[model samples]
Target: MDGKRALYYAAIGIAVLIGVSIVVSVVSALLSLAWAIVSGIVSLAVLAGVVYVLYKTGAWLLGGDDADYSASDSVGGSRSASASTDAAAESRQDRLRRQYVEGQISEAEFERRIASELETEEPDDVDRKVADIEQELERER
Candidate 1:
């Protein structure tokens, strides 16, 4: 199931558990000690069960290779992926291009930077161009 459906089910389950607990507490208060103890135990068990169900269901809904999500791994993996996507470089290039257009850099300097970027061995010349542009823009500012 999707996240929204999971949330809806969780809300309903929580409401029902709370309602039962309230009813149990009220009934216990009206009963003898022995009965009150039994009622309290039952209420606790039910609440625990509800919590376990929610935990399991949530885990199932959020699909991943492993049940355990490592904080560092998730953060690092996405960060690396994004770094390779060229977004970072493109943003930089746009700024540099703007600077060049605004006469912050002489045409020869701009061409030189572009040429150097094109000659980079990184295999992602587009990204390098963007990075170069961004560098120029940042320097201009």
Candidate 2:
């Protein structure tokens, strides 16, 4: 009777496991179906957007607003962007000179700053190059 009871418990445990597995598999299948539907919707939306862009681009190449793009006509200004940057640099140099003449900055500081602006090379870069050359010369010796 003891052996029979043990066998019965083992059979019951297996039955419970089978039931739990069936429920889990059913839930997994439902989740997979939901994911497939959501992905299909997203894919359709992306495909539609791609088609619209292509159609508008082709229309623009032909120089007619056939597809009716929502974006405004122009993306750039008339003048080159670098023109303002160059003017700003010239103004800054003039200001630096004026400040130095007015005694607002020391002569040494003014000279160093002017060199930095004119050369566009960092002081550290100069130091690094000198170190490299010295190392090369030492290796040759």
Candidate 3:
């Protein structure tokens, strides 16, 4: 009778030990999964922040107002012909200035282009030449 009682107690102890081990394993797995989810979210948030910063920096560096003006100007075509011509000339000058500032063209080349742009008396000729120059620049790019 004594031996049987001892065996019963040993069996119960083994069962309890197995139960505790299983509980610990399950809790550890859950914690690991939670950590992985948190890490993923943090990584995504960091990536989004970097992209936002880059976008804002680019807009600031490239002149946000210029982009806005071009968009609005293209959408609204109600300006007078003379005003449009003057705007076109100003746009061309701005482009040339940007190119020069960026070192895409030498000072002499920039000056020559500006002079050629200014020498055109007729609006039609100016438009045609400007189109040609734009095409050439695009090809170079």
Please tell me which predicted candidate would have the highest lDDT against the true structure. Answer: 3
Task: Indicate the worst ten consecutive residues by lDDT in candidate 1.
Answer: 70-79
TM-score for candidate 3, residues paired by index: 0.44
Measured by TM-score, how close is model 1 to the native structure?
0.26
Number of the top candidate by TM-score? 2
lDDT of 1 by residue, 1-141 (tens): 699999999999999999999999988877878787898999999999999888876765563333343232221222244334555343444445656778898766876766664454355655644555455546666
Off by over 4 Å in 1: 1-84, 121-141
Q: What lDDT would each prediction earn against the true structure? A: 0.60, 0.61, 0.69
For candidate 2, the per-residue lDDT at 60 reads 75
For 87-123, candidate 3 gives per-residue lDDT tens digits of 7675877688678768899867986987787686477
Count residue pairs with overlapping backbones in model 3.
Answer: 0
TM-score for every candidate vs. truth?
Answer: 0.26, 0.45, 0.44
lDDT of 2 by residue, 24-133 (tens): 99999999999999999999999999998988888875535243323322221122333234444434544665576677987677667756665654466445433543
List ranges where model 2 is wrong by over 4 Å. Answer: 67-141
- Displacement of the residue 106 alpha carbon in candidate 2, Å: 82
